[model samples]
Each structure stands twice: as structure tokens, then as C-alpha cells.
Target: MSLTDVIEGTRQATAADPANAQVSFSVANTLVPGTATAVEVRVRDHRFAVDEPAPLGGTDTAANPVEYALAALGSCQVITYQFWAAKLGIPLEQVKVTVDGDLDLHGFFGFADTRPGFTDVRITVELAGPADAADYEKLKQQVDEHCPVLDLFRNPTPTSTTLAQLTG
Candidate 1:
């Protein structure tokens, strides 16, 4: 009868059935040519080539995992900037960030490969806003301190991993 009633009806009709809920499973799979072949990594229902160029020979993406880490930081910086811009009522025309890091190819801990972890990272951001340089600089400082992801990365957190077996 009312707008709220009509909207609620539409929402209920479109919502998934709670009685027969669906569960999502995350899994990773990889296949290579042979013992001589390169490595491959597959995850989240997508496959990627570990050796040659993807699609051509395969999805030979950039450095393993490191690329993802860089992207994560860059994305967080952009999102944080946007959040502050909206809160301060600064109309932003564009927001951009460049994240770079260095690592030794050799694995640490005297492993098979002596790849070194990221030694350093640099992030550069560009934002267009009505706020003056002084205000923008202050906001940038605040964002660096308040951004959760940035803080987490800046100060490493201890973590543990466990493998669980599912039983039916």
C-alpha cells in the first residue's frame, strides 16, 4: 500500500532463498607442462600461466605475489584519499598513486631460492581538490596515520597458518 511496503516486497522477491543458502569455496590449482615445464598458479576460479606469456604461451604475469602486494597498497592510498576528499567536501577531479618496491630475487632463510623480501616501498599520490596545499598536506599526513592497511604494512603483524581437513 505504501512505498516502503512495495519496495520491501521487491527486495524480498529478488533476495536469495535463505533456506537454501549457497556457500562459496576458495581453491587454488596449478598445472605446468612437465618436470621441465615452468610453474602455474590457479586461484579463485581463474587460471594463470607461471612460465610463458599468458594467452600467447600462458599468463606469464609479473612477479609472484609481489605485484599483488603493490596493488593492494596503491589501492588503499587511493581509497583513503577519496574518503577524506568527500568528508572535507573537496571535489576531486582525479586521484592517482604509484607504488614501487624492491626485493632481492634470492629467497631468504637459505631456501632453494634466495629471494629477498621487499626492502623498501615508495608511494606517490596525486589528487585534485579545492583545498590549499597546506590543508592538503595536513590531510595527507592524517591519511597516512589513519589508513588501516597502510598502518598494517608499516608495522608488521604476527600471524599463524593452520590447515584444516573437512569431514562429512
Candidate 2:
């Protein structure tokens, strides 16, 4: 529906579960040998494919995984801005954002000691709103502090993996 509906729904859900407001999301993926690298991912009722760049081995069919991560981060930042702006009664006209990352492929090819993921990422938000620069800066600070994906990238979250095989 609308963003207002999401905001109101979030408010009601938080009120209902004040103590533990946690939700779990899951996605399944499958891979098969082909000319190009590809993975079929199913999330909820949606299905999509992820592929690497031509140099990386794919035919540049779809966005690579790291690109998807950057996209997710950018999207989460926008959502944070919208949610907080609504909650704080700020007149947010429009939110535009750009996210970029630097990569050191040495780590991927097992060359140097560089990290495997984005070495650095920058997100620039161009806000079109009635609020002045100070208000915009304050809201951006709030987004940096409260955005879940930002936290996920900035800090460490313990994760466990389990594997099971299906017999045919």
C-alpha cells in the first residue's frame, strides 16, 4: 500500500510487541552449472536471479551480490528517512540517494590481505524538503544511527549456518 500505511502498521506492531519486536525473513537459492554464473533466489512470493559481471565469469545478466548489498543498504537508508520523517512530523518532500563502494579484488582472488567486501562505502543523500540544512543534517544523523543495514555493515552480528541435504 502506501508509506503511511507502513508507518501506521509499524506503530501498531511495535505497540503490540513492545518487548520483542523481532521478525525473521528467509530466502532460498539454487545454482546449476551453466555458461554463466547465476543463482535463482526465491524470497517470499518473488523470484529473481543474481549474476556476476562479465569479467567475474557471468554474462552480466543481472546485478551481482555485492551490488545487491549496496542497493539494500541504500534502500534501507531511504526507508529510515521516510519512517523517521513521518514519525517526527517533518515535511519531507523527496529523498534521493546514491551509494557507492570500493573493492579490492586481491582478497577475492586470494592474493593480498585485503578484505573481500567493499573496503569503503559512501552514501550521499540529496533531500528536497522544506526543512533547512540543519534539520536535514540532524535527520541524516538519525538515519545513520538508526538504519538497520548500516548497523549490520558497521558492526558485527553473530550468525550461524546450518546445512541439510535432500535425498532423491
Candidate 3:
């Protein structure tokens, strides 16, 4: 089918129920439920306080640093794909993301010349549903192109840090 046909079909499916099609919520959490006695998220931006988990290396159970990276990439892919699915009206039965990264302890601990973080990362996505191969490929391309995390990874932004003391 032509690109227009594919897009039109997806639209038809998504428009069936706009209300239940999706819900929006800002996701921020410190840790999994039951793992900690209390969770607190401190936003320096002064918006509001949210109950979030303590630092990863803290006494409380925390997801490893690598897991956090995987989570970010995986979440970005899933959300990006879902958004397109809803907009295109594609019947997305399932979307699975598996991210893997490799690093060396020597580099991480600062004994080596390599970077302290992940040297390489791989994000694999599996979509379940019925659609032509070309259509599926197009969907995958769009998701990859639009995924925020992927864009960030592909074209990294510079970061700067400053130290300050809080006065009481």
C-alpha cells in the first residue's frame, strides 16, 4: 500500500476512541514500592517535592546505574512508538525494548583511560501485531527517528556543572 493509505488506516484505528486512547502523567519515582520505608524526590527547580527513592548507592535498595540507563532508553523507545501507533492508528499489540551496554570496571573506577560510563549500547525493539513488512518498517523508522532518547544519544548535548553552597 502507499504511504497515504498506511497513514490513513492508522488514523482510522486511533480515532475510534480518543478518550481511552491514552492518558498523560509525568512519571517520577524514587524506587519500587515496598522496597523502601519512605521515598522522597527533591527537585531543586522548586516545583514540588515528590516521593522518590534515595540515591542508588544509598543503604536502601536501588536500581543499578546501568539499569537506569537501560530504563531511560527503553522507556523512550516504548513511548515514542506508542505515540506514533496511536496517531497512525496502528494496532500495537505489544512493544518490547531490551537495552544492553558494556563497560569496564577499570574505566569506571578511573584506573583506565576509557570513559566512566557505557562505551556501547544496543536497543532492540519487538512489535507485535499484523501489518505489512513495509508498513512495519516505516513505523520502526519513524519511532527510531522520533525517539527522544535516541536523538539524545545520537547527538549528545554538552553539560556543565557548578558548585555552590546552600546558606541557611
Candidate 4:
């Protein structure tokens, strides 16, 4: 089965049952022992480490959380471009995304009033295909409107935190 077919099938199924369109994802993480800022993350069957660079007091074992966020945005943009191109019947031979984000450590350290997250992010999408510029522009518009990670970055999401105690 082609990706177009799969995309259309999913669209039809979701249209028939709106509940099918709503889904949730989850991941688990634990702080690595004897590390200042290293964590082990579990997503389904996959496992990876997340840590800051040496300058941030971590052992520089892996990409930091902010880097992961940028990666998520870039990867999501690529996926959205492919799916939108297929759904719109636009020929997409290749797609590449580049993401960059700016952060200020003063916020994390509480030394200043700056926000503790990315203040600005930039994304560049390189597309290669037979489609004309207009078609590509249309695809870009659709992707900008539909990409989940982009939405997460553009809009504020309500979040809550709870404290749990573990006893041995």
C-alpha cells in the first residue's frame, strides 16, 4: 500500500469517527545515577539518554532537552510536508528541515527575568520536486497550518505539574 492510500484511509476513518482523530502520547524519564544532569528516557520500546553539555554541569553524554525540542520541530515539519504533499497530490521528491532556537541561561538560573525557554525559533524547509513554486507554497501553507509541533511552538498550551514522593 502506498503512503497516499494510507493517508486517505486515515482521513476517511477519522472523518467517519471523530474520536479516532484524538490521541495522546506519553514518555517516561528517570535521572541517571551519579550524574549531575543526565536522564534516561523511554518512549515505547525505544530508550535514549538526554543530557546537557559540559558547560551546563552535565557530562555531555547526549543532546540536551532544548536540542531535542528543536529536533522534534524539525522532524515534525518534514513529516507534515510529506503528508501534505501526498494528500494534495503534489509530487514531493525530497524534503529537508532545519531548526534553530535561542535560549538564555539567566532564566534557568533565576538570575534574570528572562523566560526559561526558547525565546525565538527559526525553521527552514528545503523542498525538491517537480511541482511549481505555487504548488510548493500551497503545500507550505497547509503544513504551517497543520504541523502539530509548530502549533505547540506558536501557541501556549496549558500545563500542570504535581509532586510525587517515592519511599524506599
Highest TM-score, which number? 4
- Model 3's alpha-carbon lDDT is 0.69
Per-residue error for 48 in candidate 3, Å, reads 14
Tens digits of per-residue lDDT, candidate 4, 42-138, equal 9999999999999999999999999999999999999999899989999999999999999999999999998999988999999999999999999
Model 3: colliding residue pairs: 10-88, 10-89, 30-52, 30-53, 39-52, 40-52, 41-52
| True-vs-predicted CA distance for residue 106, candidate 3, Å | 2.1
Residue-pair clashes per candidate: 10, 0, 7, 0
The C-alpha stretches of model 2 lying farther than 4 A from their native spots are 1-5, 32-36, 166-168
Q: List the candidates ranked by lDDT, beginning with the highest.
A: 4, 2, 3, 1
Candidate 1 error regions (>4 Å): 1-59, 108-115, 164-168
Off by over 4 Å in 4: none
Of candidates 4 and 3, the better by lDDT = 4
lDDT, residue 32, model 1: 53
Give lDDT tens digits, candidate 2, residues 1-168.
Answer: 767787788779889887546788999877746655798889999999898999999878789899999999999999999987876667799998789999999999989988898899999998898988888888888898999999989998999988889676
lDDT of 1 by residue, 1-168 (tens): 643465456557658565433455564634454523245566677866444344334355444456667887899888877776655555666889999988664554455565467778989999776778877787788679777668867996786878887565
My TM-score estimates for the predictions, one after another, are 0.59, 0.89, 0.64, 0.97
- Per-candidate Cα lDDT values, in order, are 0.67, 0.87, 0.69, 0.95
RMSD of each: 8.9, 2.0, 8.9, 0.9
Q: Name the weakest run of 10 consecutive residues (lDDT summed) in model 4.
A: 1-10
